[model samples]
Target: MLYFEQLLVNGLMLGAVYALAAVAYTLVYGVVKLVNFAFGELFMLGAFITLSLMAPEISLLGHVVPMPGLSFHAAAPLAIAAVAALGALIDRVAYRPLRNAPRLAPLITSIAVSVLLQSLAQTVWGPGSLRFPDTPLSQIPAVHLGQVSISGSNLVVICAALVAMAGLQCFVRFSSLGRAMRAAAQDTTAACLVGIPVNRIIGLAFVLGSGCAAIAGILYAQAFEFASPTMGFTPGLKALTAAVLGGIGSVPGAAVGGLFLGIAESLCAGFLPNGAVYQDALSFILLVLLLLVRPQGILGKKEMNSHARGSLITAKARKRASMVTAPLRAMDRLFASRFFDSWTFRLLVLACSIAAGLLVQSDYWLSIMIVVLVYGMLASGLNIVVGFAGLLDLGFVAFWAVGSYFTSIVFIDVLQKQFGIDVDSVWWLLYANLILGGALAAVCGAILGYPTLRVRGDYLAIMTLGFGEIIRVVATNWVSLTNGPMGIRGIPSPSLFGYEIGDSRSLYFFALALTVVLLFCIGRVVRSFVGRAWVALREDEDAAQAMGVPGTRYKLLAYACSGFVGGVVGVFYAHFQQYISPASFSLFENILILMLIVLGGLGTMIGPFIGAAIWIVFLQLSLKVPFVNSYPESRYILLGAMLIALMLFRPSGVAAKARLRLVMEGV
Candidate 1:
């Protein structure tokens, strides 16, 4: 009884911190309807700023000046102010210009911003978690309540949270600026017409939300007595879950949702076996469940189901669309006059590239080509979802991970543990694994897609992300099956008719062959009825549904096909590397894959090939360069900058070819 009581008290206090962060997400989402993926980074930034400010002395441009450290009270306000300014700056730099662009543009920018900020923090903080200085505040005594004692810091956190919530409620209700914010959130055009300064109001939303995040950070740091660059990500995600659970866009809903999430997490962790290891997974599970049940959120008034598939058909997209189609029109004229059509020409080009790769006798170059081919295949598969189906899947790595683990289990565990057969004796299992692994991944994909595909836009993206994280968490914790973080090793190399493919050169040729087969198969599918249905769904889900297209069926089909490709590639990866590890299949890898497809051309058939080549080659060459090798992290920073630049200037991508045939017309 005492333990339960203690859990309740702890849950409420933790919920207070989560509530503060949740409000930040709600406030911004309420007005602009943007997810602000980088918001967590702002929370992290605020904590660091407070830490720096509380330092005994500050250094500027190689000069250090003696200074007295400020108390928590003084540092908290300063950090809030600093972070608020940074939030406003972020809006101006990353979000503002892309306001009227395609919805995906801003979301992608947010991701890039998130990466940039995280990378910057890593570089600044030296990749180490930090602890607050042993200050006067942290040493305060605890308050006991019938064996449910609360620390002084936690009490302060709860009190401060209540005050902040009350203050926000009062300000929003009575202040002129608050009214202006509400007006703008309701109807930006109307607010603009009424001279409400919609732009400034939007900026203010970011500012105020950032301030709340600052408070959340300070309180979190205070209670925990430690801070880290990544400390904000999990909490930020939980807070978003709380915001959505409470009813996004509703202040009161966010508060209740936070408490609910916190208590649920606390109880689950306390009572369940190995619950502490899986605590992070709880938030994502809640998010998916809530999105399925009530996408409007618990208290949300509006549906908040903004679709993105066809939303990109704005003026900018049309302009890009025309540019995308121009080369096709020219090709049509050329193909009409020439001996072969565009399709035949493309086949010939592919054949030539394969022949050239085959002609390369050097093992090193073949090894490099193997990576290019693998990523290209992965990118192509992903393009089917993001570029053709118009689903922004951040969890594509989940499929890859699934495929890899399935194959590893079959070859390593099943062979060794169950059958008691040496892996080397069952070289033929590789073929079976390839077929079975892909089938399993397809099944998993169907399951993942079935529930969340119904949700629209960023909601779907977030849900998929959660699904991906869940897969990783399960893989990390389910040690009996996945071998935990140590990963699987000593897997036998794949062989054909007892001929071992142990050489890098042989693997390269093998990977290239698989790549060719998969690309051909995928290309044919893209030109088939199934592909047209996917394009129809992407262009407009409701309209497609009206036209007798099963939105659910096509989506599941996309996932299955994409997952099949991912799974097959995973098998190839496992054999090629002769090992498998969870670390290889991370969220960052998913982002990198997305970058490949986007940088290449979203829906273009040839885009993945070009994009993968450029990215892989750049990475390989960058490491060999002296200056670049000195600053390894600069590559990601540059990539982030490139994403921002691409979104702003050329949203169509580099290889956005004009299609001669329309997939929507069953071409």
Candidate 2:
């Protein structure tokens, strides 16, 4: 009874924190219909800022501040202010310019913003956990009620959450600016017509949301006692889930959903076998079930549902109707011309590029090249789902993990145990694993898509994220198959007809060949009729269905294709590293993949490749640079600053124009 009571109290407190974070996500989505993938990073940034200010060694005015004085407690409020400012900045920079662009443009920008922030945090914070300075606030005594005891920190967290939520409610319900925000959320055009500053309201929403998140971060750090650059990923994902579960656009709903998720996760951890380890999985399961039953969320208005569905239909119809017969007419004209004769020159250029890569004998360069190609494949696959299909999938790494685990399991069991295959031959296992892994990934993709296609936008993203966490949990705890956290080892490399490709030179050619094939296939699909249907659905779902475009089928196809490619890459990754672990497929990995796709340009064939190249080069260079690597923590600061600048200056991404042209050209 005591344990249960304590668990309940802790759960509720945790839920309160989640609720606070969810409010930020909900506010952004309420007005803009965007998931704000970077929202989590905002919270992360807040925590880091607090840590920086409170650290005893760090002096603000060229003098060290003694512990537990005004400087220590002041860190919390200052952090909140800084994060709020950043939130408004994010709106003015990343989202404002892309307001009228395609849905994918903003979605990609959010992802880039997320990566840029995380990377910057890493650079500044030194990639390691930072402990907050001990203060009297943290040393407050615990309170006991009957058999259950609650710590001062938890009590403070709960009380602070309630106060913040209450304040927000009052502001929205009674204040003029709050009314303006509500008006904008209800209808942006109407709000504008009424002379409400819609853009400013949007920015205010971000600021308010960010403030809440920052406070939550400070409270969470107090409770958890440790902070890191990557800490935001899980909480961010959960907060998004909570926002959707409670009705994404509703302020009260977000609060309710956060509490529900936190409590459920706590209870699951307490009661289930290996519950502590599988807690994340249980939370996701609850989210998926909740979405399946109540897609609109617990406190959401019913009117929003019809509006969402109608918008999807209208967009799909417009995009499909505009493109029908146009592509066919162009194809007929091209067939009568000398377009085919140009293929010989294209092939020659491709051959020359391949030769150039092979001639470079530097193993280090080859390894980097392989990584870039693999990421390109992953990014391209993600683009099909997010860019063309307009689904915000944050669990892409699930497919990657699925592929890797599948290959590892198969190689360990079937090839070695039953067939008496040589495990030492890393090359043969690589090819076989990739083929089998892709098939398994497609199957998983279909499974995830079947139920989720009914949900759109933020709801879809949240559900998929839950599904991804479930996969990770299973991988972590399924000791019999996955070896638990011990991870899988001795995975092999690619082989062709029994010829080993373990050498750097051989692997380079193998990876390059696969990348070219994959890129070509992606290009062909994007140019095909099916690809047009995907774009039409992305633009407007209901319209596409009206045009006989089978929205669900096409969505499933995108998932399957993306999953297959992710799986293939996973197989390559497993063999390349000769090891696979649950940590590799965490939510951070998913964010990184999304970053590559978005930063490069979603919906463009060359976008992922270019994005991957830049990311790999940046990562390698950052690690080698004396200024960045020397400090360890400075990289995160640089990465965060860069992301903020990018959002402010180029929300459309570096390759946005080119990607838009490619998609428009196909149309």
Candidate 3:
């Protein structure tokens, strides 16, 4: 009973910080309807900022600074202020320009902002976890009540959370500025008509939200006595889950949800065996369950069904076929006229690419080409869902992870466990695992997709992300199966009738063949009735359903097909490396796959291939450069800048114009 009481106290303290962060998400999402992916990084920044202010002195460019340390009282406000200003700056710079753009534009931009912030933080903080200076809280002793004990820091956290939440509630309920925010959130156009500063209100929302996150960050640092660049991601993700659980737009809901999630996590960790390792996954499971049962959230009102917007290439098609650019348009028409559209040109390009791959003698270049092929395969699969079905699957790596694990378990672990065989005797198991792994992944996809039948857009994206995280957590914690992060090793490579695929050249050809097969399959699907149905669904879900298209069936098919492609790539990946690990599948990997598809041209057949080629080449070449090679994190900044630039100048991507004629002709 005493232990249980301690857990309860700890849960309440944790819940307080989560509530602050959740409120931050709810506040921004209420007005902007954008799930600021960068909010996590904002929280991380707040902690670092607070650390800087609280430290007595710090090193800068090999020079020591003699700045005096501020107490928590003074530092907290400064940290909050800095983060809040940054939030407003993010609005003015990254989001404001994309206000009228498609739903995907702002979301992608937010991810870029997140990457940029994390990279910047890493650059400044040097990627090491630092301890907070010895403050009163750390020095103060614990208080005991019978057998139950609580620390001063815990009390501080709980008290600070209550004060902050109460203050926010009062401000939002009674203040004129708060009412203006409410008005803008309800209807931006109407608020504008009523002379409310809509833009400023939106900025204020970000400010208030980021301010809350800053408080959460400081409180977290105080309670944990540590700060790190990557610390905010898990907490922020759980808080987002809480926001969704309670009712995303409801302030009260956010608090309630945070408390619920915090308590649940604590109880699970304390009571369940091996629960501590899986505690992070609990919030995601809750999020998925809530999204399935009640997507409006615990306190939010019922929302309308998600409506698909339009094809990614719709505007690009118009520009290419438009008479506004007479010479360019005429040239495009001529290119599509006769010789350019012939199979001869297409085969010629294909032959050239094949020749280049075959002739490349450098093992390093061959390895890069193999990676490009694998990424192209992943991107192609992702395109089927994000591009064709218009589903934003941030958890695409989940399928890849599942496939890899399944292959390892079947071929390596099972053999060792059951048959006492260290080496795989039957090479046919590779082919078997490919089919088995794909089928397993497809089933998993169907399971994930089924729950998300009613949810769409950003909500669906979060759920998939949670599902993905859950997979990783399970892989990390299920020690008996996955070996608990030491990772599975000694997996055998593939062979076909005695010709082994152990070398880079062989793997490159293997990957290239698989990419060709997957692309052909995807192409055939896109040109068929199912493809048209997916396109229709992407354009408008209701209209597609009204037209007798089975929305559920097509959507499920898209997911299944996507999982199959990813699974195929995964099996090859496992064999090529002859090893597997949870680290191989991460959120960043998922993001990279999506970035390639989006950067190339969503929904276009050749876009993923081109995007993968460009990305892999750029990454390889960039790493070899002297300056950038030194500061490797700088590449993320460049990628983020590229994403922002792409959104602004080429939303449909560089290949969308070329893909336009093919799509039109198919339709």
Candidate 4:
């Protein structure tokens, strides 16, 4: 009984924090009918800002409080306010312009914003975790009442959350602006028919949501005691789930969903054996169950917008056409054009490039290059889903890991030991493994897509993210197959006809060749009928459907294609590295891959390649630079600042519109 009570208290405290984030998500969805994929990053920024402010030398007001002595009461409110401001700024810059665009445009913009923000944070904070000073509230002794012990911080968190919710409820009900905002949420045109300033109200909603997120961030810091560049993901995803569970556009529903989710997660983690490892999976199980039972959410009302709906159908047809024919056209044009008219010249250039790379000679540098190629492949695969199909996939790395593990099991376990096959000659294994990997990932994709395709925008992003976590959890805890965190090792490198390509120079060429081939294949697909369908779906799902495009079929195709690419890349990744581990394919990997696609330019052929090159080069350069490497913790600060600047100046991407126009002209 006492244990249950403690669990309830802990769950409620955690739920309060989730509620704060969920409210932000709900508000944005309510106003614009779009999910802010970057919402979690905003919460992360809030916590980091608080940590930076509370750092040793910073002074609040006229007096300086020693960093070691910073109190929760002092830091929490300020952090919340700072995060709120940042959130509003994100809206002003990234979201506001794209508001009038198709739903996919804003959704893509949100993803880019997320990538830019996360990268900026990583640069400034140095990709390392920071520990905030433990506050007085945490130090307070726990209060014991009837076999239940509640810590002071937990109680404070719960009370503060309730108060915040109540305050919001009152403002929305009684304040003039709040009423206007509600009117806008219900129907923007109807609200505009009155005197409500829809845009301003929308901005205000963002501000309010951001502020709530900030509070949640501080509360989370107090509870967790550590903050990292990537910390926002788990909580952000959970909050999104909460919002969906309660009905995304309903404020009261979000609060209820958050609390319920928290309690459910707590019960699963605290009571189930191996629950800690499986906690992530439990969230998805619940999400799938809920979605299957209630497609619109517990409290949501379905009101389809005709314009948005029509757009989706048209978009779907275009995507389908592109998928089927684009690849062949691209290949034919490449061969016929002056750019690749001479195979001899291309071969000569490749030979020289390989020679030059070999002469420079650092295994570390070679390894980095290999890593870049691997990422390039992963980014390319993700582009099919996120760029072409117009889906925001937060857990793409899960498929990458799937391919790696599949190869490992087949080559190391079945072929080598059982069949007495020579592990050294693994090239044949790779070919077979890649095919199998793609198939497996496609199956997983179909499974994830079946339920999620009904929901568009942010809901899809969150569901995919939850699915990714479930895969990771299974990988971590399925001791019989995965070896349970011990990870699979001693995987052999690729060997073609008994010639090993494990040598750095040899592998570089091999990887380069594969990247080129994959790029060609992907480029072709992008110009095909299927690719056009994806773009159409992305641009406007309803419109695409109305044009006789089958939404479910096209979406499932995207999932399968994306999974296939991811699986192929995964097979190569395993053989290239000759090692397989769960850690290599965590949520961070997902973020990095997403960043490449967005920073380079989503839905473009050359964008991911450029993005991968820049990211890899910068990462290597950061290591060499004394200032960056010396204070690793501060790197994310620079990254965060850069992201803010990038979004402010180049919302589309680094590539100029003229360049894309030229490419289109060539095509």
Worst 10 residues of 3 by lDDT: 315-324
Top candidate by lDDT: 3
TM value for model 4: 0.82
Clashes of 4: 69
TM-scores of all candidate predictions against the true structure: 0.91, 0.87, 0.93, 0.82
Model 1 earns a TM-score of 0.91
- Local accuracy of candidate 1 as per-residue lDDT tens digits, 1-667: 9998888878888999888889999898888989887888888888877877787874422357665588767887898999999899988888888777766777778878887877677655645677765556667799998678988777787888888977887887799999998898888899999888888998999999999998898788867877787888888888887887787788888888888888888888899899888987887898888878877678876567667445342215323345645654564454334334356776787787678667988777778888888898888888888887878898888888888888888888888888998787778888888888888888988999899865777677778888988898888889999998999997778799888998877787788778878878887898888888888887787788999998888899999999998888988888888788878887778888887877766776667777788877787777886745765665666678778777766565665443314443323
Query: What is the C-alpha lDDT profile of model 2 across 1-667, one tens digit per residue?
Result: 8888888998999999999999888887888888887888888887778777766564322345444334656887888999999989878876787676545556656776777777666654556787766756678899989878898888988998988988998999899988898899999999999899899999999899889888888778778988887888888888988887898889899999999999988888889888888887776888888778877889987654432442221122112222533443453453334442356744874796588676888899888888888888899888889877767787888899989898888888677776888866544656666778988898899898888966766667778878888998899899989988999887766667777678877877778888888777877887788888888877667777889998888889999999988998898888888899999998767877776766666666656877788878877788787866565545545555554444344443455444532234345
| Local accuracy of candidate 4 as per-residue lDDT tens digits, 31-54 | 888788688888888787778666
Residue-pair clashes per prediction, in order, are 2, 31, 1, 69
User: Which number leads on TM-score?
Assistant: 3
Pairwise lDDT winner, candidates 1 and 4: 1
Instruction: Itemize residue pairs with steric clashes in candidate 3.
Output: 246-298
**Candidate 3's C-alpha lDDT?**
0.82
lDDT of 4: 0.74
Q: What are the lDDT figures for the candidates, one per model?
A: 0.80, 0.77, 0.82, 0.74
Tens digit of per-residue lDDT, candidate 3, span 226-322: 8887888889898988988888878898899998999999999999988888899999998888877887778887762254366433432212223
Error of 3 at 261 (Å): 0.7
